[model samples]
Target: MNMLYLSVRQGSEKARIWQICDELLARNGVPPSGREVADIYVAEGGNQGTGFTQYSHWKKEYLARQEQAAPREAILLSPGTVTFRSMSVTADGTIMLPADIRRAMLLDEDGRVTVSVVDGELRVISPMVAVRQLQRRTRELVPAGTLVSDELIAERRQEAEAR
Candidate 1:
């Protein structure tokens, strides 16, 4: 997100800047760290350090927003994905991921993912996984709760079983 700078006339300017940054992060996925952007801003623009200070404050707010999502997104794991396995984290913290699995996930440079530790194994997942898992419980994906007839539900369940 572009940092807000040089317009010191308004009282709610800081909040406005932070909301923009929050939307930017959500749209583009989290960066390596918020500080890196601010550091680059100063390096490129030669502005006084106020931008860095503003970013530091916004980073805390952005991170808090991320934290707020954790609980709401929690899900009970499927039998297969919950199985135990061993893994080793690389020195630089990369975990080896299978190409087929990565392809199935459709991961991209700007994509965001969720990681879980299940029985000592690394579980990197797409947000769709949570929605699907919740579907098992609520039988609906959208919060508006579209009604599904029992016959249709049973037919779909049978079809899923056949697969």
Candidate 2:
């Protein structure tokens, strides 16, 4: 029944009780049990029923706040973009991708990554994603209905004839 004689302002007894509960929980990084919180409230000039009810409501809100603040490994970013800063690379040349990036890149199939350096930045790309990017770029650069393979073959034939 460790408690403090806290001065409660007029009409702010509930706030004072909740503040006491927070301070009690924050002390030593280990929360007191429900009975302890209720006992402390009683020691602070509050009745048993109000103390227990206030402590219960305060506990629920505290847990909800903690859950909301917890970090999540998987998160959504803008389309076609996943970014990480200051990620560690092991001495054995292994880099662990975050869960959101892995999910966005569809890395679950074979877990293969194509590593490349572009513009002095390390890039880890999925094989299928890389191929899709290449196809999209080629389509943007080449005209429709143009046979690039046939043109390459014709140039090869002319070079052989000249030789």
Candidate 3:
């Protein structure tokens, strides 16, 4: 998955801050952590040099890399909720989601879903789709004795023959 950092310029409005956070959450399916948010800072004038320049420079560099590395779209999720279907882990321990799932969920290419491992169980961390389509073969191959009545089956056969 992708990691994004948002930095606000000096004198940025509170609404903008909230908006950016909301957008990030919606696009990434998770809220940025305290550390991530804290990393952002405002800059002072060039003459003062009160660490603003350094922070600004770092922000620029980080933004450039982020823009280039990140996907065009970003997925956002609600607070305290994680969506699992949108994320996966690679062999190299990099967190990511499959391309098809990303596309279907409208998540950014670089966006990631959080994952956690505990008690020998691997869990995907997200609020992905709960219902999946059953395979056609599985649906067609209903076990015997599970049917409430054979009338439906007979009707299906008749319809097939008619076609």
Query: Considering every candidate listed, which one attains the maximal TM-score?
Result: 2
| Alpha-carbon deviation at 115 in model 2, angstroms | 1.3
Q: What lDDT tens digits, residue by residue, belong to model 1 across residues 1-163?
A: 4433223335454544444455556666753233454454456553436544565567555445555656633422222233345667799997765644544564423345798898996667765455556767785543454455765899999999999
lDDT value, residue 43 of candidate 1: 61
Top-scoring candidate (lDDT)? 2
Q: What is the lDDT of residue 8 in candidate 2?
A: 31
Give the per-residue lDDT of model 3 (tens digit) for 39-134. 342321222232333433443344455557676344222122334555566789875545654546433233545557899977553222211223
Ranking of predictions according to TM-score: 2, 1, 3
lDDT to native, each model: 0.52, 0.65, 0.44
Q: Please write out the lDDT profile of model 2 over residues 1-163, one tens digit for every residue.
A: 2222133343575666677676876674644455676687788778888876776566556655565666543322212556656788899987777766776774522376778798998877775467668888989987899989999999999999999
In each prediction, how many residue pairs overlap at the backbone (N, C-alpha, C within less than 3 A)? 0, 0, 22
Candidate 2 pairs with clashing backbones:
none
Q: Which is better, 2 or 3, measured by lDDT? A: 2
Off by over 4 Å in 1: 1-88, 96-98, 106-109, 140-163
- Clash count, predicted structure 1: 0
Ranking by lDDT: 2, 1, 3
